[model samples]
Target: MTIRSSWSRAELGAFGEQVAVDHLQAAGFQIVCRNWRCRYGELDIVATDPASRTVVFVEVKTRSGDGFGGVAEAVTRDKLRRLRRLASLWLAGQDRGWAGVRIDVIGVRVGNSPAPELTHVVGVG
Candidate 1:
């Protein structure tokens, strides 16, 4: 098997998304979409839970550490607004008729120091 080179920021982000997917699944969130994008911005993960019929819009932020800022700190009000817009668009394209909707933020810090830590912040109105 050939191994691809990991040398770009975009590649790193993609890897982070994969890690985020595993983390989300382990937490019982069924994967709906990955890298869902619009002209405004992109959503890292969109999941649906069958038990609660809740649609969750998740923002995955991978950072080295709190050197510059924490992953959650990166989500600004404007960003949330954009994410909401995209989430609305996504829902409009679907007929799931979910019972509830939520906005979540999953921050991942991956490094050699320790195992990846996933912090899921739910209901980010």
Candidate 2:
């Protein structure tokens, strides 16, 4: 059976982020913040991987359809550069030190099914 969603675009994006958070937690990431923003841009999800002791800045791209392209396709070189800058800003604001920093991208494809398709591209930046 298929599950239909009546959520608006923003709602869909929020839902996707929630799904991403859940997936990340299950994979052993401790979520630090969500929707962290600055004058530059926004970081969709900030997480810490205990095993790697690394701070991960995540960019989430959520789409209800694939007419344009895969959700990951939306992350361009410019976007990656922006993410890097945002990550630096985030670190500068922190009081303590991080083991390391990495950038990741989460692509969420929401469809008629209740379970959205998710792809995690680690260390994209």
The sequence of per-residue lDDT tens digits that candidate 2 reaches over residues 1-125 is 23256768788888889889989999999999999988899999999999988999988888888876885688889999999999999999999787889998888888846678898998898
Which residue segments of model 1 deviate by more than 4 Å?
Answer: 1-7
lDDT for model 1, please: 0.79
Q: Lowest summed-lDDT stretch of 10 residues in model 2?
A: 1-10
Q: Which ten residues in a row have the lowest lDDT in candidate 1?
A: 1-10
- Report the Cα lDDT for residue 5, model 1: 41
Residue 31, model 1, lDDT: 97
lDDT per prediction? 0.79, 0.87
TM per candidate: 0.86, 0.92
lDDT of 1 by residue, 5-111 (tens): 43366765676677778987887879998888888778889998778989999888876557757766878999999888999999898966999999988777666
Give candidate 2 regions above 4 Å deviation: 1-3
